[model samples]
Target: MATQSPFPFLDGLFERIAQGPRPPDWLVNEAQQRLVLLINHVLMQERAATERLIPRKGRVVRVQWRQFFVALQVTPAGLFDLAAQGGTPDLRFEVTETSPLGLAQAALRGDRPPVRIDGAVDFAGDLQWLADNLRWDIEDDMARVIGDVPAHTIASVARSAAQALRGFVRKSGAAAGGAVAPWSGNGPLP
Candidate 1:
């Protein structure tokens, strides 16, 4: 028997969100800019990640899901800038999962969403490497603003909460008879 969503209403809610009136262009632009800045900040924390991207400079990479997308171009300094509208992307990553709830569940399980990638082989390899190796040190960043002790305490609490949530998600999935298959990266996207 196919396992059903415990919260069936979430499906309708997500549908409404997907079909809702689009945000204004200015808002979307601002959000994308902030996303890029956050990505750049994380990249700067890892020298190897920046080095891996440096050779891919000038290449455009577009990531999309449904009707939403962002295109970024690698810069000579191993950072990313929002690509111009007309530039053809050298690499494209399309997330295959359409359900927001499914995506969130997979994330909670510490799995990457299924993605269809098409583009330069080397660039894709570099990006894969970055994904596998790079992680933001949120606690370390917090330490800069707050003192080390407070930051560590907060991080510890957050980690414990995340662990509890993951445990709950795992139990729920098992009870649901593994309806959501984990993405292993070797299979075709979706």
Candidate 2:
């Protein structure tokens, strides 16, 4: 039997938002700059990740979802900066999933959302390797900011909450007629 979302209005709401006017260009640019800074910070933590990116320096990669997009160019220091306007991207990735709720569910279940990739194959392989290997050490970062004991306790609590939420999401998805299978951690990326 087919099941429906308990909050069906969310689909309509998301559709409306997607069709609505985009945010101001300046605001978008600022947000993208902040995002790049965060990415560079994470990359700096892992020497291997920086080394992998160094070879791809000057490569422009653009990622898009709906009307929003960000173009990033790899730098000599193995960090990313905003790509110049009007330059063609060496690689482009467009996220295919449109529903915000769907994306959230996929994330909670540890699944990659559907994406359509274009451009260089070699570049794509490198990006796939990075994704597979790179993970932010949130606990370590927290420990540095706060103290070790408090950070450990807070991280433990957060982990427990996340696990509980994942379990609830899995149960709900299954009850909704298996719209998405439970993630096994080894499943193929979409």
Candidate 3:
């Protein structure tokens, strides 16, 4: 027998909310710039990551998720900067899933949503390499601001909370006939 989702209400609510008008261009642009800063910070932490992109300098990669998109150009400094013009992208990735809950769940489980690609195979391969190889040390970043001990403590506590949340989701999934596997990289509802 087909079963109903535990989060049917939330699913409907999210779907309705998503139908609303998009954010303003200025807001979107600001958000994209902040995202670029965060990405650049992480890249700077790992020399090898930027080094690999040296040959791909000046190439533009566009990433799209629903109505939002960012076009990045590889800089001579081996980092990413916003693309100057909406010119042809050397590589493009379009995220298939649009549900906010689904994307959040996949992220919690350390999984990537399925994406459709259009453009250079080599550039795509480079991006895949970045995804597979690069990881940011959040605790280390925190340590630079706060002391190492305090940063470690905060990181540990945060990690514990996340683990607890994951455990709760898993148990809820099992108890509800496996419906709430949000962290399992499954559909948001089932």
Candidate 4:
């Protein structure tokens, strides 16, 4: 848990979106921000879990863009497009992305997403620009979103949630028990 700043930007963004005519520039910025954070968090967990499952040896099969992953589908581990740079995938799998907080609330009520995996990750130094940095340690929601194929809708939703969480984390800090930055330590993002 880390402290965050109030995401007045996101709040205002959302408010603007909700208000009426949408601004194209605002929407584009929102989409980029959304993808950056969603991909980062998922990859963060995926990285941790993968490290534990795949033994460090000669080399783990680097899943290409369309490689066979799950038992049923011949697909990549997660959702990806041909435009997405990488070796051609062998297969594809469905993905349903539940927000961290949303998933927790769901668990409390006993309403579970078809598949679920959990992990505690230290995400202090992760960047949002790496393609091969997905976290496999956490459960892949891919298989759960769609029955036989990766759903584009889920990816979109996941991206949105990721952006919102990024905004929240940026605005708020770790609860009351985590790390603390100095008043002047908040200089600028590296």
Candidate 5:
């Protein structure tokens, strides 16, 4: 039950794993990166659920930022030999006393490239789009997984990616721009 990607570009992604005799590092990176994004998404979902929102729509699982960040850290457990390219935390974010404008200027000079977290970020527009596109889908998906089967946010679904995907779907009825965080609902930002 591999979830059908909302974006068609991803269809070829999983299939690439078997095409070459030697698995591509890109494939490994892709899978590992997906896992990392999944980690972040689930963390956010768990938090949202605890806050008693819809409890289940997730759309941010495709970001590559985590790959850039996680590549810097190695697995503490030497069991499956992992790759660590960056420092401990892959994404390096620091609180600064600088003004927003000044901070933006300094961040422009920060190390990015493989460590993609330092890239210029525009949250306002993206948040608005997420609210419109994913809001209802997230809630409905949450109901199916966390509601009926009770899969914990971090767990990889009921079992494999297939089963997990069975519980995931895009809500057709959900309007675009409904994925509102509590802050968007006139609450304080977390």
Candidate 6:
């Protein structure tokens, strides 16, 4: 039996919105700046992440998703600086999935969105290492400003909320006749 989408109207609405006019350049730049700021904050937690990129200083890496793109250059300080000129990229990553719904589903299942890569093998390896090892400890960062006790309590609640949300998503997916792939180990791929 063929299963129908639980929210066909939402699916169509998303498609239409995605096809609509792009945001202004300034807005896009602001969004990119905010994203970079967040990434830098996360990077601050792991000194080794920046240190590994030191040798790649001045190298440009371009990452693209849908119509949004950010070109960043590795600085001598080992952090990323936006390259407004967008000179030739030493490494480029383009997200293959175009549909917002599909990407959201993948994320809910803790799966990585497929990406097309174009870059030096060594740089790519280093990037992969950074991805695999470095993780932002949001609770630890919060504790720095809010004190350990409150931060721990907040983090615990946040974690529980996240787990509940993930469970809801999985159940909704299954009820819709869709399989939610596991992040790792066992379970069939969607």
Best by lDDT: 1
- Which tens-of-lDDT digit does each residue in 1-190 have in candidate 5? 6776689887777666434345467887787767655534543544432232222122121223221323322122211123344323322333332233333323333312332233224322332334444322354466666673343443344345644332221121122232211224465532
Instruction: Predict model 6's lDDT versus the native.
Output: 0.84
TM-score for each model: 0.84, 0.84, 0.81, 0.21, 0.21, 0.78
**lDDT: the better of candidates 1 and 5:** 1
lDDT of 2 by residue, 1-190 (tens): 9888899777688768667877899899899999998888888988988898899999999999877899999999988999999999999999999777678889999899999999999888988988898888888999999989999999999999999988887887787687754456786622
Tens-place lDDT digits, model 1, residues 11-100 = 688778767778899999999999999999999998988998998999999999878899999999999999999889999999999888
lDDT of 5 at 183: 27
Considering TM-score, which of the candidate structures 3 and 5 is the better prediction for this target? 3
Deviation (Å) of 172 in candidate 1: 0.6
Per-residue lDDT of candidate 3, residues 59-107 (tens digit): 9999998878899999999899999875899999999888888787666
Give each model's clash number. Answer: 0, 0, 0, 40, 15, 0
**TM-score order of candidates, best first?**
1, 2, 3, 6, 5, 4
Tell me the tens digit of each residue's lDDT in model 6 across 26-73: 998898889788878777778999999899888888998887789988
- List clashing residue pairs in candidate 3: none
- Tell how far residue 147 is off in model 1, in angstroms: 0.9
Q: Can you give the lDDT of residue 29 in candidate 5? A: 73
**Candidate 4: where are CA atoms >4 Å away?**
1-150, 174-190
C-alpha positional error of residue 131 in candidate 5 after TM-score superposition, expressed in Å:
29
Q: Relative to the unseen true structure, what is the C-alpha lDDT of residue 171 in candidate 5, on a scale of 0 to 100?
A: 25
Candidate closer to the true structure by TM-score (higher is better), 3 or 4: 3
How would you encode candidate 4's per-residue C-alpha lDDT over 78-99 as one tens digit per residue?
3221223343322322224334
lDDT value for model 5: 0.36
Of 5 and 6, the candidate ranking higher by lDDT: 6
